[model samples]
Every structure is written in C-alpha cells, then in structure tokens.
Target: MSSDLCGSRLFLALPDDILTIITSSFSPGDLCNLGLTCPGLDSFMSSHKVWLFQCDKLGLVPYTTLIEWRKGVFSYKALCRFLVNIQPMIGTWVHRNPELRHVVYVMPGFLSVVGCRIIPQEIGPLGLEDGPILWTPVFEILCNHVGSTSFFLHGKERGVDYVYPGLLKSVDRDCNVLLLEVEHRHQRGGGKLADLKNFTHEADNEVSSSQRIVGRKWTEKPFICLESDDRELLLEFVTSQVRDIVPDAANVLLFPRPRIDAVDSQQDFIVLHERRLLLLQMYERGNMNHDLKSDEGSPLNPTELGSSEISKSVDCTCNYPASQAAETKEFYSCKHWPYMYESLSAFYKFPIRAPKACDEEYAGLWGGTFGLPPSADKPGKPLFLIYISYEESEGKQQMIANKILDGKSRLSPFNGSTMFIVNIDEPSMTIFPWNTDQQSNPISVMQSFKGEGICYWSRHRYPSIEPGSLFVLENGLLVYLWEHAREVLTLKRLYLGELLKRGERLPSFPPVLNFAHLTS
Candidate 1:
C-alpha cells in the first residue's frame, strides 16, 4: 500500500503472459501511465493487442464486433475515436412537442448509426415482451473507413421511400437542442458538404451569394447571417444536383430493442444483424464513397460531392481543386420537402439527463400525471412530460415549464407554450394544501415561487395560464396549485425511457399505420 510496494521490482518482473493479463486489468488511463514508465513497456503497450484490450474495456460493443470494426479504421486507436465520438448519440431522444411524440432511439449499425422514430399510439393487449414497438427509419449517420460521419435522412414521397443524403460537418458532444432546417453550400470545386456555410429557415429564404460561413452554428437558422442574393439557386441546386435520392423498400426493421432483453427483441436482433450488413453493401453499390479495404492515414477529407457518386445523374463539371477554387462561394440549396423531419431527428443531440439530489441544473426534463381519487380510474390518467428552462424577462429570473407529452384525450396546446411561469423572486403566500406530501411523508419545501398554472380549459379548445403558486419539494417534486380551480399538479424529475421500460409493455400499431406516421 506504500510507495515501497508501489515501486517494487516484483510487479515489473512478471512474465509476459502474466504481464499482459495484469495490463489488461488496468484502466485505460492507468495503462497509458504504465506504458510511459519505460521504453520496453512503451513498445509493448503500443501493440495493437493492447489497444484492442483497452477498446474492449469500454464495453460498448462486444469483443467479436470490435474485431470486425477494426478493419474500417486506421488503427484500434482510431476505432476507439469513432466509438467515443458516437457514444453520446446511442440512446433515447425525445421532444417536448406533442406533434408525433418525437421519440427517437439511436443505436449502432454496421459501421453506422441508425435513428428510428417510435410512433405514438395506445398499445394493444399483447404487452411489452410479446408486443412490438412500431417505428420507422428516420435518418442514419454512416461512417467512412477513416471514421468521418455522413448524414442521410429517410422519408416517403409520391408513394416511394427514399434516402436523402447530406454532409455532417461535425457533432457537438453536449448539444441540447434538436432542430430541422435547410442548409446551402457553394457548388464550386469538389468541396465536400463539411465546408458548407449557408443556412435558412424559410422554405424560400434568400441567401446572399457573398455569405461565407466560417465555423459551426450552434443555434437555429435565424442566428446564421445570410445575404439576400439568389433565392432560387440554393434550393434548386440542392434538389437537382447533389440532392440525389436512393430508392428504398419498406423495411420495418430499423432498430432492435436490445435494451429490453425480451424474447422477441433478441430474436429480431439476429435478423437485424444480418440485415444491417446487406443494407451496408447495397449503399456501397449505390455510390457511397467508402473504401472498405483502404485505411488511409487521414480520415475522410472530401474534395466535394461534385460529379461524384451522389451526383451521378447530373453532369457535374466542377474541376477546380478544393484548395484552388474561386474566391466567391457558389450556391446550392436543399429544403427538399420530404426529408426535413427525418434529417433533423437523425442527428439527435441527446436524451434527457437525470436530475441530481439537490441544487440540480435549472433546466431539465420533469414529468407528472393527474392524480385520481381512490375511486377514480387509474389507467385513465396519462403521464405528462415537460421541460423546465430558466430565463430572465424584464430583469426577473423566471422558470418556465413547457409541456411535451400528455396522455389525456383532449385538445392539444400550441407549440412552445409554457405550462407555468414562476417568478423566482416572489415567495408564495399560499400555504401547503396538506401537511403530508404525495408519498405520505412529512412535507419539506426547499423553495416556493409565485407562478401561473396552465391547463386544459373546457370552455375553449386552447388552454392559458392562471395564477398559481409553485412549491419545490424535496426529492425533486414540484407541486403547483391553480388558485381558481383549487386543483393541484404534482410532478417530479423523470427519464421517460426508464419510466416506460419499468411499466407495462404495449403493442405497436399495424404495419400500415406505424410506418412513418407523421402527424398532419
């Protein structure tokens, strides 16, 4: 336990077999430090086998799969790079909008990442295990041999399914917002989509030809600067040239519910495994520019999509070297009608984060349900999901909770309406409704705020805010009391995926209704 034992020669003298076993047990960080101790260890630690062991320690992918993935990258180190970069995306993503539930689950595919949208519907009696989760292929982030990612959006149009390809310049590891928009680029030189700069929100927003995007834009399109030059050219070039579509068959299987650990999911995983490989091959045949056999020293640095595989149908005459291209940026726009939503959901920012025990981030996902009296129907009450965000209005710090998913069979609220707005500076004058909380425990209030409650009003289809007091309780519970109606809304910090998994399994809709069932 002391420094003498730490520097002892006995550990260094272990035979090669035992040494490797010991090294394999070390954490990736510790192993690197061990490697730096001596030149003999440096060479040994740099071996492919040692890196592979470190890769396996991550436990993201199985060992057998790592062997297969090794062929696609320059080295085990590069493969690890791809894995770490994408690990944030491999989970559930949801939106606060009621439009289509916006429940997208991301999972790994054959050297790619697949995004599947889970349709919202009442599950049938088959239950979760025997039942299926209805979903459609939303988008995919495919990997090049060198680990660069390409984006593809899936959608149906004119009675046909298609994949609209695009470029992913890069992804932020901690992105919090999800948005769908139209992006433009100069069509000169063989510049890849990564170097693009133009962006617009309007279906017909005009972009100035002189606008040059220097770096990534984190916010929505409105924040990006654009000059009003050629309006039609951006959208026109996107649809005609680089915006080539790939014919897609109706494939219900996009993701295997690997986390559920049920019989049906495991059984489908076998078929899904083989299905992914075949899909990868077909994509390669249809002009995907990846060299499976070549592990180039550098990653994917494309000259451009000009006249290459994606733009085969059009006669692209772009010949200038990427470095030698003209000064002015050429324009190509893509707000192609069909693939908007699919593309947006494909590059999911992240799922919700769990709230801490105390003084958690002001912005997080919170959920609640309408509490029923002892005799009321239990199953009738639906789980409601909302996102809590903080902002300053007129120099007053206000906490706003926006409703996402509601189970009630009532008219829906408008998009982006705050369920409650709390003035954090004002303390609540209203006393607690009951001495005990929802769990029959003693009431403990961390803080209280004067706010207004927003709920469904029977008089009209749309709901509005009413005066109320918000009580922040212990263990992340938020209680709101509507002053007029004297009704209470109880909520808590929630992770939707976890709640759904622990609850009952529900049946998916028929295949006809389930596939890409976007709300009209």
Candidate 2:
C-alpha cells in the first residue's frame, strides 16, 4: 500500500477516544485547520472536549464561557474572577515598565471580565487585601494602557487623571486614589504642592519653550495632547492588542474621542478663519460704525452700521409690521426668527410623517371603544379564561408587570379581559363572562359576556390536565359549537341508516316521528 493510503487507513482505524487525545495535543490553530479536512475529522474535532478544557487552562475558556453565558446556560462569574486575578499580574508588569504598559492593559480580554470577583484566597499573595475584589474591566484595561508611571506623572502634573477618581475610588482607595498622589510625589521628588506650582509656571510661559519641548511637556503631564499621528498610533496599538486578546474588543475601543485636542484644534481653526473673513468683509463695506443716535427721526445712514450688526438689529425687528416697511431686502432674507422657525418646524414636520397605519390601528383601540368597563356588582354567568404564564418565577412576573406599567397613562385594555394566555401552562378550563361595561343589562346576550373573565390555563401546570380539554371562548361562546351541533345531527342520520340496512320499516298507521327521542 502507498504510504499516504497507509496513513489514511491508520487514521480511520483509530478509535474516537484515541483521536480526541491526539487532537488535544495540537494547538488551537492546528486543531482548527485539521477540523476542516474531512467530515470524520470534523466530528472528532468538535468532540475534543479535552482540547477545550486545555484552552480553559490557558485562559481561553472565558470566550467559551461568555458564549455559554449569552445562551443563558452558565454563569460568567468564574470567568470574570479568572480575568480579575490576572489583572494584578498585568498591573505589576506595567508598573515595572511604564512605556509598554498602556499597550498591555487595553489589550482585548483584559477588561472583558469586569464584574468578576477576585478571590484573594485563590490568587497567591501579590499583597492584595483579604476581601472580594471587584474590578471594572474597562477602567483597569484603560489604566493598563496608561502605565502607572505615566498615570502618576499625568495626575501630578496635569490633573487629567482626576476624571476617573469617581470610578476607581471604590475598587482600591489607596492604589487608584492615594497611590496616584504618592506616585506623583515620587516622580516629582517633591510634594503635589510643588508640582502644581511648576505646572502653573509652565502653562504661563508657553512662549518660553519651543513647540517640540512644549509637546514633550504636555506628554509629561497627565493630559497628553495627542497630535493626529499620536492619535493614530494609540488607536493602532489598542486595536492590535485587542485583536490579540479578543478580536471583538478591538472593534469597540478603536475610535478616538472627538473632543481630543487635535480634533478640536482643527474645528476651532476653521471657525476662527470664518469669523476673521466676516470682519474683513465689514471693513471692505465701510459698515463698522455703531448706530449711536437716540432719535429714529434722524436720517439713518444705510451703510454706517456693520453688515453683521445691521443684520442682527433688522432681524430682531423684521417680524413687526411697523418695521416691515423699513426693513431692507437683506433683512427679509437673513433668516432670523419667523423664517428660521418656520423652516425648522417645516423640516421637522416633513421628516416626521406619521406611520400610515397609526390612524386606523389606534383610532378605535383608544377612546373607550375596546377598553374594559367598570366591574359589575353581580355576574350573571361565570366565564372561564385560560391564559399561559410565560414567566419562570413569580417575582419575575411582577417585575415585568411593573416595568410595563411604568410611564404608561393607560392600562392595557386586554388585561384580565382578552385572556393573553400562554401555551405552557397545565391544560385546564376557566369560565367567566366578559361583562366589562357592567351595564345593568347587556345590549345583547353576547355583549353582556364581554369583559368579566378568569385565566386558569398555564404551561407551568402542564401534564396535570389533558391538552385537548382546555378551550377558549370569544363573546362567551365556543367557536366550534356549530361544528359540534353538526356532528350530533350526523349521528342521528347514522342511526336511521343502520335501521334501514337492518330491514326495519316505518309503520303506515299514525306513527309519531320523535326526533328528540331519536337524537337522545
């Protein structure tokens, strides 16, 4: 036999248990590649629970755990704890080397474990306190990216780190809060008091330093003013590191904040240039003088006031009938209040057209047409309504009801009347008349049965009652009653047919045809 054929035969001959063991020995990538080879191998690859267990040991289990948790099958708490336990290790590494720490902390999967409990007992003493430590994965991940040294330096020098004290204070008051000052002090070799003074002097003397030096100074401070290049680099690092840990995390945090210095500077520069151009236009038009004259009777020089100010003044009064005649063509088209308001209202009104079916669907449903009437003092007939309960727990049901009721001015018209039943409950029957209008006498017999009802069927009670026994009534009558009556008539015809087949004949002498007796 050929060597390839021999190998294929050998592989095919191996037991599933043995194949699983061999596949488990391969890396995740290798196993993934092997899984694509053949149907038999794919089945073996999928069954490789031992390989998954190994992945868990290497901290890859959390992703699997996350998927399971999303499916509502398992708790993510343990995975969270695992992430939390590893956080300090990351912190320790970052603290030792500040430069690459930011790259490490914001790495994907770092903060994916937020809300996980860090058990001090399970993790060997890195001197963490003896309590359940819950870390915000996002903050910790961000903290990791901005290394301890950089964070301390920034907090002490620029006060930028103060934005997170509210978030980080609960975790470790000393480390995230007090340690900030301590680290700052250590970095400065002087107190926070001295650092503030130095920072103030540096800000006041902006002209004393070159742009390169000023940029470096900003970097030294907690608030790093990122250039376009720096923003790109930061995003690139965050994306790459997140992809390494968890590809999904990279997608979320890759966008830079719009309010950052580089972005704001560009926007501000454009606005400033626009304002400067307006000023130059006013100078060219010879309209920079103020309208200081108190009397309106005095002749007004049309070009004396700045075009911008004249536009503003005319816009303020252009709506009045008295000023309408005096207003220039520019004032009419300048788009002050009436024109702007109308334009905006029109724009909003045009875009926010009502849904086509809203009028037809809601017209009668509201305004008391389909709503429940007041309860009656006496019920003439009992009506049973069977509804299924979808909620797993009683507490959950109440919570859902409260949430539904919140901010709602009207109760659901169908509540307790329409029998919004679920299919999961036990097969059972309830009888109640719909008597919501509670009029002393119903307009019609069927109308009297409108709203008075009771729900009894629920999937929670299934198997106790036979499935077909449960029935629903609309307008207090069974929908299948006519069919049932037809079946009764058919039975009578069958009885008469059988008699005829048996050679039985009706008597000629005055015999009474008792249909009631025949039906019975």
Candidate 3:
C-alpha cells in the first residue's frame, strides 16, 4: 500500500447507474472532461446510448449549423478541415435526415444552432469508444415548422371593412398566389401614382429618411397581395410588414395589388415575386444546392446544337486530324455540358410555368367536370375542395364558386373516384362532404357541424372537427388556410383565431414549407 492506497481511500466509489446519474447533471463540456479523466470513466462516456440519454435529459442534441465547432470555441479553420475530411459523412447525415438539410447563410460572427433529440446512435464513434457512436455533429440542424408566425390587418382611420371576399380568394389550390396591398396614408390628399413613385425614390436616397417615411406615412400595413418593385424594396417592405404581425415572421408572403396590364399579358408579377421570395427564403434558411466541377478548366458544350452555325462547326470538324479533332469533339460533347448550361439558366430565369387561363366561361375552374375531359373507368383518388367561410355575402359566394371551378378543372377526377366538395357557410357552419356518383348530382354527407363565425371542412375526417368546437382566435384576426385541409385547419385553430378576436390582421401570409411539410 502506497500512493494508490491513499488515493483510493479519498475517493468514494458508487454503482455505475448512480455514477451515470451524477455525471448526467454536468454541463456538456464538464461531462466531456470527466470522461477524459480515467479509463473507467472514458469507457462510460464513449457509450452511444449514454450520449443519447444525455441529449434527451439535457437537450443537447445536434442540429444543422452555418459553422462547425470544436471544444467550446468558434473555429473556421476547424470547420474547413472538418468539411474536407468528413464530407462523405456529412452527406450521409443529410441524406438520412432530409428534413434538416438547408442552405446556410452566415456572417463571420453570427451563429445559428439547430438541435435534434431523435438521432440514431450508429453514425459516428465518440473518441472514448472503439466502434462508431452517435455524437452530435459539429453543426446543428434547424427546424422550421409552420404556425410559428402570425398575421394582422389594419383599416383606414375613417372606418374599417373586413374584406373577407378578397382574403378568401388570395390563396388558390396550388397555394402560389398572394394578393397584398400597400396603403399610403398621406395620399389622402389625392397624390397621383407618379407622385408616390417620386416620394419612394427620394425616400430611398438616405437610409434615415427611408426609415422615417416608412414609419410615418405607411399606415395600416397588411398582407393583402403581392406587388412589383425593385427586389430590395419588395424584400424590405415584406420584412417590415411581417415584423408588425409576428416579430419573427422570417418567412412571409408580400402580396402587391393586382396590375391589370400584367394580368392581361399573362405575366403574373405576383406569382413571379412569390417564387423569387421563396428561393431567397430558402437560401436564408440554409437549403443550398450542391455544385460539382471538373478537375480541368474545360468549358462544356453540347454536340446537337440547336442552331445551324453550331451544327456546321461540329460537322466540319468531324473530318479534321484524328488525334486533335477527336479530343476536341470529346471536349464539346461531354455529358455535363447540357446540365451545366441548364443550371446557369435556372439561376437567371423564372422556373415556374405560368398557369394557362381557361376560357371566360370556365375561368378559375380546375380540371374535372366543368372544363376537364371525362375520367377513366378505374379512376384514382378524387380531388378534394375544402372551403372555409366566416360570413355569407355576394363576394364570399363568388369566391366559393371560383374555388369549386378551379378545383374541378385542375383535379380532373375519373369514373369511380369523385371530387369531394366541402363547404363551411351559413348560420350554423357545417361540413358537407359531397362526392360525384353515376347520377349527375353528388351525394352530400353531413359530419360534425355548429357555430357561426367560421367553418372548416375536408374529404378526410379529423379529430379537431367536433360539435360546438370553440375555434381559437388570435389577436382578433380570422384564419386563412393554405394547401391541404389538415395543415390549414391546424394553423387556423392554433394560431389565427385569437388574432382575429383581438381585431388584428397578419402583416403577411406566413411562408409555406414546400415538400417537407406537405409529405410530413
């Protein structure tokens, strides 16, 4: 007995389970340090399950991040080295967790951390362990869920009219349209559109003046429709309006008033603006596209060129010296040529195809009975049109009719399957699920129905639809649904109801999460 006996006497040993409980209470850094102190401690610390348990208990799960870190400090050099060494591992992580992937935008000092508690423990090994363990990646994943933002409406000081009709029609079946209006309070003096334009230009000259003008002159900011302007101004206005409704309305839709000329030309500035904003928001949220480059700086060119000049060059060069010409032709006809060109084009041009307008008789109708061809014998699922209305009016009626037509034409149901028409309207808002049968008139089945202010309906029944259900309102603002029935209702009951009751309107339509939210 010597130094070993003395050290052993001073330390109190506990069972493994009890020791784990004690260690779990330590901070992440401390826990890591304790694991390094002795062989026995290191073995326990390296356990993947142990780390997972710690994540659940302490909420230290890893998420996507703009930069990777080591120890407790910010390290760009470490991040660069990590990216080079573990790129394949990172790719695997992203593939496994597709929802967490995003395009990371960051400044030098700014940091955003995303945490995930549900990670599997087989990816990588902690240093203390022999095999792979699920250690939090250097960067965290960001979670962007819906219902995180709010909306509100402000009316003219004289008196306010709740333009429910316009609001109902703003979001179509595809969830692509956003109609917003910008009101100029000082324009009460009858300033011309040209005058407003000049005012906007002058205001842009100085940042302080711009802030003052936006603060004082722009009153009653609401997310009514999308507008056309310089990209920066459009972004600024959108961000400003969103701040009024939800200070963290990071993702939003800014609708500008309709332009009659643009509408006639089939150049929907609103749709274009929405797509642009969507891409920008995606970039901001860290959903970046990967780019692959060749080792040599060779420019890729297509072999089957569209124009006669290019065709001639290829044909003429076909008979040149075998060695030099063969290499030249191979360079031009590389498979990567077309893909690279298309990638560049996508960056500059609008990618979404504009919806072709139906004739006046079938305007706004989607594909089914109204203007669509007849369905096949064994049809697939029928398209569902769920309409929510708070009050009855001529405008509301028109909106409903327009939605029905649009859904019918676009969906184009087949023989067996029928389009389900659900409406929430009248003294007692009720859900009427109507499906087309062999007989021309569709059968209507009444589900849970009650109350007056607003109604919700869908082809699929959900738990939220109940008799005498008290629809939750936020800030005195009515709820508007986007995309499918479930998400729309979920958002409404959870976020919009209180806003409506409080007499507020959303400054902007919250941005819709694309494929991830839809499929999930």
Candidate 4:
C-alpha cells in the first residue's frame, strides 16, 4: 500500500488483460488519473472495453443504445465526456409555478436529453397502476457530432409549433439554476436566425407595391436599413421572407404585426421580421448582459391594436410595470407556455406510467399542511388530507381524488366521483364533474363549483386559484391547492402504517381505514 510497493516494476508488469479488468471498476476520473501514472496503464485505458464499461455505468441510455450513440461521437471516451457533463441533469426537475404538480422528467432523447412536463390529469377507471401519464416536450439539449451541446426549446404560438434554438451554458457539477436564454444574433454573422436579416429591399418594394401594409405606421417598424428612406422597404421585404416559415405572425414580430391587407400571403414575412428583431434582443442580452427590465415593453400599445396611426403611438411609453408584463415581446417567448413543457417521463427513479395509470412514482399516501395566502390577511393554517388512486368506473379507467380531511371543516368527506378522465398523452386535464342528478354536462362555471376538484392543467402558474389543484416539484414534493384560497398542502410519500404508528390519523377515519383503499 506504500509508495515502495506502488513503485515496484512488477506492478506495472501486470498483464494488460488483468489491468483492464481491475480498471474496469474505476470511474472515468480515476481511469484518467491511472493512465497518467505510466505508459503501460495509458495503453490499456484506451481499450474499447475499458471505455465501454464506463459508458454502461453511466446508465444514461441502454448499453445497446449507448453503443449506437457512440458511433456518432468521436469515441467511447468522447461519449462519456458528453454523458458525464449532462449527468446531473438526468433526473427529476420541478418549478414552483402554475399548479405545483407541474413535474418535469428529464430523459434521453436522440443523442440528447429532453426535459418533459407531466401534466396533471384524472386517473381513469384503470386506477393508478395501469394508466398513461400525459406529457409534453419542454426543452432539449443535444450533443453534436463533436460532443458540444445545443439547446432547443419546443413551443407553440397561435397554434403554430416552433423550435427556438440556442446554446446551453456550461453546467456546473452542482448546478442549481436552469437559465434558458432565447437564441439571439446581436453581432454581425452571429446566430442562424440573425442571418435572415439580409433579405433585400427589392423584395420589399415588390410586396409593398403589390400589397401595402394596411394600417401600420412606418415608425412602428424595427430599425431596418441604415438609410431612413430605404428602411420601410427593407423591413417589408424581410417580413415576406418570415411569413414563409411562421404562418401566424400577428404577434410574432419584434413590434406588433403591421395592420396589413393580404395578411395570409405576407404572414410569414412579418413573423420573420419580428423573429429577427427578437434574435437581435437575444444577441444584445448575451453580449451586453442587457437587463430584462430594459426590454420589458411590447412594441404595441393597447390602443394600437389595429391602428394605422403608428406614427402617433411611436413616441408613447407604457404605464405598466416591467416585472408584471407578459412575455409576448421576448425572443422565442412561446417556450414559456406551460402545456408545451411536457417531456417523455422515461428518466427517473419512478416515472409516471402510461397516461392515467398510476405508478410507484406518485401512487402512495402523502401528507401536508396548507397556509392561507399572504394576501388573504386571514389567520389560520389548515391541514389537507388527500388520497389519489386509480379506479374503474363502468368500463373505463379513472383517476380519483378523495378528500378525507379539510382542516377547516373535517365533517364532510368527499363522496368519490369521477374528477378527470385518465389521459396519458397530454400535459393538462379537463375536469368533467357531472351534475349530482344528471349523467352528462359538467358544471357550467368553475366559480360556482362547490366540490373541490381540479379543472384544467395550465403550463403557467395559476396562483390565483386555491385548494383542490395539484402540482409536483422536482425534489419530490407534491403540492395540492384549494379553490379560491391561498392555503396549500405540501406532501411527501409516506408509509401510512408508519405514520399511523407515529400517531397520525383523520378525525372520523381509523388509521387502518384512512389509507386502506390506496392499494385497491
């Protein structure tokens, strides 16, 4: 064990096969250091078997899939380099927004890793054990042939899907932040999106002469050509090009879409103009560290909706606070939509099973407390006891939410009824609470709702609503909310028997009866 024994020539004389077998258990860092110790060890470290072992140990993908993935990279070592860098991100991630049950499962994509959002929905009649979990794509970090990472965000605007491409920042081994910057091209010849700025004025002249923008003013357009006289023509020309790619360009521009005639034909061009301007903002943010507050206002005003008086509104400033503004003006801002954030839940200790079906990840007893919102200014914290399970109704699968204890009023336990139809392929679910006396037609308005239940799952945080809504966090905390109330329940999976042994129980239900039906 001492240096005397390590320095012995016999140690280095060990056969290559034996050395590889021993180093097989070594981590990537350990193997790299071992190779540095001597020329013999270095030669053995390069064996495909040694690197292959590391790749398998990473467990990011199947061994066979890793093998195929390696074919696209420089070598097994390079693949390991890529896998190791993104390894920390290969687990559960959460955000405290929309409903707390907005869970994002990071899993393997084609030579990349995707962050998918698990939309909260009803567990159909199939119960939790055999239902599907609806999910949507949020963001993806792909490894290039050279092993560098490129980030792409999936989103929809006006129902048109688009991928906002950007570069991933260097992730620290213990990274606690996920900062996604929109793609930009502030510098000359920067991003791919920025290059589209070169669309010629000749094209603009043809479009403007053929179909002049109907109601937009010249000042409202982005700064295009250097010459004031030529800027409008250049801007219109670029708009034509953008219309080809993004069909819905009304609000896709850096400024509001020009109130123009023949919009269908020129929609892409306008969107292209806006897209380029957004890239410029991204470029400015990246290079200058521009404050998000500085770029807060949208290009259009409330009254500018369809105004041909753009010149009149160009000099005006908005009265709204930057912090409270929506993200319509940001580059590739559609990624902020909640529903588009779902990803395939293939990578986790316990990923959600097929839609509507409950699995170990979320099927268990959970306990938590609910505190009234600060704005409520009312005193008193309430205990929220909920049991979520998969059950069958008639012949279809159903996800049921049973309220056992309402800390405020414990007398009424919710009579089990179908809350949401178990769906596995979407991020949000629509609640269909039937009339107590009728078989069809869910309650007309959510405000008049008396039964505490979830409605639709939105990608954005719905902080305005209260109890009965559910959200999940990345650290494995399940958040449930009540209607029109700020009080919340933060729950963690617990052994009901153990909790009962420790003296936890509902007022009316015995310990055995409390969580007894969870397994059924």
Leading candidate by TM-score: 1
Which 10 residues in a row give candidate 3 its minimum summed lDDT?
Answer: 320-329
TM per candidate comes to 0.53, 0.21, 0.21, 0.40
- Write model 3 residue lDDT over 1-520, tens digit each, in one string: 4565443232325565666676667755575686777776666666544444444453221322221122212232222322222111111101111232211111011111211111121112211112211111111212112101111221111121110000111112222112223322223444342232334232344444334333323322331122222212322222222211111222221212223465532343334334333433543432122111212321222211122232122211111100000000111211111111210101010011122343121112122111111111112322221222222344432112111111122222211121221223322242332244233544333322233212234443422322231121222211222222322221111111111122212221112110011111
* TM-score head-to-head 1 vs 3, winner: 1
- State candidate 2's TM-score: 0.21
1-520: candidate 1 lDDT, tens digit per residue? 5565444355756576777787877766676787788776776766787778777877766797687667665777666656766665666555433445555666676566766555443333442223343456666766665656555555543344545455444455554333332344435552543232222222223322222211122112432232222112222233222223342322544444446456775565565555555454554554443222212321211212221232221221221100100011122211110122322212223324444454336567665654521101123345455667666889988777766455555426642346788888899998766677434668777888899877675664667668999887775677777777666666766543333333333233221122223232
Query: What's the lDDT for candidate 3?
Result: 0.24
Better of 1 and 2 by TM-score: 1
Clashes in predicted model 2: 26
lDDT (10s digit) by residue, model 2, range 426-489: 4234332333334454422221111112222233332121212212323222211111111100
- Tens-digit lDDT track of model 4 for 351-407: 112323434235533434433221111123343334455545566443444433333
Worst 10 residues of 1 by lDDT: 319-328
lDDT of 3 at 204: 40
Error of 4 at 339 (Å): 23
**Overall lDDT per candidate, in order of appearance:** 0.49, 0.23, 0.24, 0.39
| Regions of candidate 4 where Cα sits further than 4 Å from its true position | 1-13, 33-40, 99-101, 182-520
Candidate with the larger TM-score of 2 and 4: 4
| Stronger candidate by lDDT (3 vs 4) | 4
lDDT ranking from best to worst? Answer: 1, 4, 3, 2
